[model samples]
Target: MSWELVSGLETHVELSTNTKIFCGCTTKFGGEPNTNCCPICIGLPGTLPKLNRQVVHYAIMAGLATHCTINNVSKMDRKNYVYPDLPKAYQISQYDKPLCEHGYIQLDNGRKIGITRIHIEEDAGKLVHEHGDTFVDYNRGGVPLIEIVSEPDIRSIAEAREYVEKLQMIMKHIGVSDCKMQEGSLRCDVNISVRPEGSNEFGTRTEIKNMNSFTNMEKAMAYEYDRQIDLLESGGKVTQETLRWNPDEGITTPMRGKEDAHDYRYFREPDLVTIYTTDEEIEAIRQELPELPDARIARYESDFGLPEADAQLLVKYRKIAEYFEAAGEGLANKKTVANFILGQIFRTLVTDEEKENGAVAIPPEYLHDLAKLLEDGKIKMNLAKTTLDKMLETGKPCTDFISEQDMGDIDEDTLRTICQSVVDNNPKAVADFKGGKDKAVKALIGQVMKQTRGKADGRKAEAMMVDMMNDME
Candidate 1:
């Protein structure tokens, strides 16, 4: 039987607060292990957790951005669990009284993924294990996190990936979280179940973990779907368990059984007071939200006349979008700006497949200047590309490199002179061109391009060659 994949995601986005949720410890990354911990965060005796008011404000902002109904009163509950990484032995999180509910994000296919709830919680510390020894760091403990739980509205790997991306974009645009996957500021756990194509009931769902990037998220979910489908087809039963995605191995390994709400043994925190927010406050946050990505993408397509594909690609990074708008300002060169961004700038700044850092480091303003220079015809296309590569290396603007090397486009007179020389040097090509051969004219243009060291615009040279060859006729 052909099966369909059903998936949902529970993403934990660490709020970009300056301090830990309950303590005064810093929430900055890459400090000495356990240095950011305090009695309140490390769960020491005689310590009590105090809720961070900023965390609630951020949570409400997130809810408003995603079109969720913000709760007027939300309480914190003790999520009882035991793990080496969790120093508190129980995480202070929201259970039944989450801060927001009933949100949705529209995918590219125009289907909305329903958000079940968005709740605030504290992050657990990390475990470092090597050579049969293990250590724990409480630095990450008490870092504020907003866990966004989505319903099983996702039906494919593609949909799952889009939902995650949309959610991340929402968080970033609203300034709720940095959503940096490498720094563990944002993390996701995917739940997948496969059932017959037309069945209404769901199959046993397996949860996948350890997905660090969007590509890995899509790939791991696809691989797991195939794995589960193969097992079910061969008469093997699907188990409800937690599986870890080993991106290196490109496979999912069974970790443990899945846990339900009761497994955590949640209870209201007696020490912390319940917080209440007003509708007017939530409305104020709603008004403060910046233009969202979807709306921006639409405006980019309509206002800038950018193709849908190019607009979508450019809007993925807010830095690039801002750069595009700035470069396009007051210049009557919108198309040229779009072309440079979608064409040259993208090529030079995105080398994820070849580079170790997985991203290019060219400054945004430099890209803007490069596009402007190209629009003014100040440099040949080949030279612009070369200048861009060098700009990526040196992080300098195009004008600096061009002035240092005197590498602007060759003058029209100099181009014609080089074309004449090429035509005079290639007698056979000239003779063939006079004999009504257009291909030989291209040959003469190639010679001019080679003689100029690829600095001449081949189109300009080709036009000059036709004129030069006709003069000999």
Candidate 2:
């Protein structure tokens, strides 16, 4: 019997607030291990938790963006658990009264995956183990988080990955979270099971915890789906447990038995008051939300005439999309702008400094000018690439670089002279073109472009060279 995979995601997003959810401690990542913590975050005696107002606002914004219904009133609860990373012994989270409910995200194939709920919670601290000793850092203990739980509607590994990616893009566009997987700002826990094809009954499910990367998430799901199917086929029972993905080995190892909700012994917290919101406030937030990925992609296609693939690529990252819009503001050929950024500009941003800072060194105006020049036929694509490299290296304007380096497109006279020189230098190529070897002219055009340092338009030069060689024949 064939088996079908069913998966859902529990994604945790760290809010981009300046301070922790219930304390005044800094929520910045990568500080001295224990320095960013405070009494309330570390759960010191006589300390009480106070909720951050911005966290609630961001949660509401997230809910609105995902089409979730915002709860008028929500309260916090204590999730009783014992772990070294959780210094408070019990974490303050939302149980039955989460902030948002009943939402869905649509996939590219037009399939809609239901969102169960989005709840606000505090993050646990980090436990670093080295040299046979474990060290606990409370710096992240009280960071605000929103847990987006999806229904078990995902049918394949590709759907699962796309769902998470779409969510990341939405959150980043709204400016609620950075969603950086490497920094632990965005993490996913996948719950997957395999049942017989066309069966209504679900198979035993296992949870894969803390898949930080999309590549790993897909790999782990593939591995786990196979593991469950193999067990069921071998006449063995599939166990319910939490598993850890070993990326290097490409396998899922059992971590521990999965715990149900009752295992956490949840109860309403007494110290903090219940949260409240109004329709006016929700409307205000909805007005402040930026255009989401799907809407932006549609606009790009309809308004700018960008292809679906190109529009999707631009809107995948909020910053890149903004850059494209700003630079291509009034240009007729927005596709040219998109191609230059995706092809030439992206290639120069491979350094560690650029990646960490999340910026392109070249200014947006310079990019706009480069695209305009290419569209106007004032510069060849090859010469534009060269000018772009120099602009990126020096952070100078494209116009200044092009002027100082004399990178203008070669005039028709100069281009014809270079094409003639190339044709005279290559007798065999000239003979081949005359003998109806159509591809031989490409070699001659390349020679002209080389002689002019990529400043000559290859199409014009190809035509000129073919004409010159035809006259000789």
- Cα lDDT tens digits, model 2, 47-73, are 999999999999999999999999999
Model 2 ranges off by over 4 Å: 247-250, 257-262, 351-358, 403-428, 446-457
Clash count in backbone of candidate 2: 0
Worst 10 residues of 2 by lDDT: 349-358
Q: Which stretches of candidate 1 lie above 4 Å from their native place?
A: 131-133, 234-236, 246-253, 257-262, 347-422, 431-461, 467-473
Whole-structure CA lDDT of model 1: 0.82
- Scored by CA lDDT, what does every candidate get? 0.82, 0.89
RMSD of 2: 2.9
Question: Over the stretch 1-473, how does candidate 1's per-residue lDDT look in tens digits?
Answer: 88999998999999999999998899998899989988888898899888888999899989888878899998999989888888778999999999999999999888999999999999999889999999999899889999999999899888888888898878876778878888888889999999999999999998887577888888888898999999999999898888898888989998865453238888998888888888888888888888888998899888878888888776777666777777677665576677766775676665423222224456556666776676776666666777777777677777766763345678899888888878788899889888988899877766776676557888878887887778775
